[model samples]
Target chain A: MTALPPKLQDYLDDFSFITTREERADFLIDIADSFQPVPARVASKPYDEAHRVIGCESEAFVWAVERADGRLDYYFDVLNPQGLSAMAMSAILDEACSGAPLEQVANISGDVVFAFFGRDISMGKGRGLTELINAVVYHARQRL
Target chain B: MSDIKSRGYANADKLVSTDWVAAHLNDTGVRIIESNEDPLLYPSGHLPGAVEVDWVKDLNDPLRRDYLDRAGFEALAGRIGISPETTVIFYGDKSNWWATYALWVFELFGHTNAKIMDGGRLKWAEEGRELTREKPDIGPTSYTAPERDDSQVRAFRDGVLAHIEAGGQLVDVRSPGEFSGETLHMPGYPQEGAVRGGHIPGASSVPWSRAANEDGTFKNAAELRAIYLDEIGLNPEEPTIAYCRIGERSSHTWFVLTNLLGFGDVRNYDGSWTEWGNSVGLPIEK
Candidate 1:
């Protein structure tokens, strides 16, 4: 397993509970465990240029970074997960790519993707944004 | 009691049974807000520990008519003992319409711990849960209200005009009858004779009744997914807007989409048709 990035390492340090990637995944799973979730399918792909990966299904947009260690850092859109206009999706892509070391995160097929995490009573839209940022920064931490 | 097999209620998670609520009626942190805004509906009776909040006056600010007021909402929340860290359980006798609206209002202002009691007061009373005639003593608490995001919500007039110009999805949560021009008595809206007495252009009608059962409680998760994903064809990743006559019914739909279905970008157009039909400059599409 590769080490985490400094920026993402700093974010994990700030959080009182979660630490490792498995812990983060477990946290999401626990939130999903609260509700009886419906069936959902997601489609994912890699953005080689931006040094990041992007995924989308009809329901959500999930973007991530592929590290040299083969770990996937995942970012997702919880607010508008299904389908977004070019303008709206463009803004989201820009926000996700900002300050990140990704070579590119673009909509190649004119389609956007969002990954449905799990049902969390406390996970608001803001948490969704936080999850995406955490995913990207953590994946970028391979060098550390 | 249609079938009463409990497809919606029995299968749902995040739902508090009337028995559960009745058991914990006196929990200190659990503040119940009475959502009966209708004057005729409110005066009759309410659940124990439930405080009244006017859907229009207390919850929303008519001056801007587009968003909720932070100070006004915080004051109301404080008066009801809803601090930022409080767990608010909302209920109402008049179905869950008002209760759901209150839930949406809390979410808009960044109060994430709010939940609507399933079946609301109707199921509680029906199941012999305690009902208090006299209002309870509510100690005021400090609730810091957050500013509502205007981009998340739009007034019906501007929303429709924007839709016509920009072409986003318009989701109308009114009954098929209302959408088809058969207007029942809609409060604070153009009822009798309007220029074009139908829904907005390209607006898909999904009756609010589809969301719940004959009882006031919402349907289960799988059922809701089918209704939104399969039946109504709502895509969670898409930018969608919900609206009703005054945004109450639509707020319920908004709750289902954002809270239950996990659709991130769902916004309720608070002005709804009341502001839309009443506005002269906006184009009317039957």
Candidate 2:
């Protein structure tokens, strides 16, 4: 299993310093801005059924690349920014799991996904976020 | 109640044609605003001289779940170069769902100069108008705002109860699944939904999408009048309320009633089903 991405850990550690929910959301949105949408090659294929993240409002997709050293780097893209549960969670997972070992990537927990934003979103959103984490972990386990 | 059809709800000039917006792209008094569910669309490409109004940051209070207060609205409007009387024309994706919602917020703040760009982004793109990648150089302006007036337009739970007791009308704009207590939320938004489902008692099922054609332009006044007045049996003199899961789509219907059909009394229950479905002892109908 892959350990969480060290850089994503760094982002969360640095994010933990932000005391305000509004400011944290602001910073996270900027991070979301930095995320690139899914590339056309993957998006144009028959992946809509296989790669579609369940329980998300927007179409959130994740496609990963396996390096020779057994590390997996994932790509996350979304159509709507207001699909905050999907977009934010996918972006976080992409950053957290990229270039990490497969099993470590599989080990990402619900707590990391839900609490990363520093605010308790609705139960429905929490469920969506969990679905996202599960998708990422499921793909990571499949890579092995 | 005021004659909303004649006056266009909050403003006389609330629905501007694409041609009107195109001709006035460089108009100094006009501030074209783009509000979308996808916040990233504007930075990519949008109508010239249009400003992006992020729903979370601009319309909503940064920390609270509520909307922006007077100072917050002022800051947002000022940053986008809108003055108290500036003609704010809103258009965006999703057939102007967020656009109308944004316009409603402007009205709540008593900005009587707000309007919706007819057909929104879809119509603009369909017409093959020139798109701009260059950001407009309009600098910020000192925009002051009055206290948000919820007197006539916004409907609270008690207010809705009173309206119902007083023989008011309610139009539920959610999908059939939601109206029938089948789905807890809109498709694909499972995370942001209510605890329960179903329609408010005495509310009629009138999905907001019915007001627009395939191209997103609103149906003519006659067609709109037929649905709300004849089919639904709503009279222009009686007060009416429209609601969706979170009030955005209902704002679309509200815009139709007050702006298009000019109903005398119209309100948008923004709290919508999320509130009604969660509250204790509130009656519902499936």
Name the candidate that leads on DockQ. 2
What stretches of model 1 exceed 4 Å from their correct place?
Answer: A1-144, B1-14, B40-43, B62-68, B153-156, B164-166, B182-194, B280-284
Instruction: Please give, for residues A1-144, the per-residue lDDT of candidate 2 as tens digits.
Output: 445667667866877788865466566666665666667764664556777777755666777767788777777776653454466566677777777777677777767754565444544455566777777788788877
Separate clash counts for every candidate: 21, 14
List candidate 2 segments past 4 Å from native: A6-50, A61-100, A109-133, A141-144, B1-13, B61-66, B122-137, B143-145, B191-193, B213-215, B222-231
Over B128-247, each residue of candidate 2 has an lDDT whose tens digit, in order, gives 897665678879889778888888799998998887877789999988888999888765456346777889989998888998877777777767777888898998888899999888
**Candidate 1 lDDT by residue in tens digits, A1-144:** 333334433433433454453344344333322322112332234322242212211123444445565444344433221122211322333343434443222211111122221122111222333333334444444423
Tens-digit lDDT track of model 1 for B1-286: 3222354432234345566667777888777777753322333356777777756567766676544678877788888887888777777744577888877777777776877777876677677756655667888888777786455543446555776577676678876766876673242222433444567776788877688876777776678888778876877787788887778889888877776677767778877766666667666555
* 10 residues in a row with least lDDT, candidate 1 chain B: B184-193
DockQ, 0 to 1 scale, candidate 2: 0.18
The 10 consecutive residues of candidate 1 chain A with the worst lDDT sum are A105-114
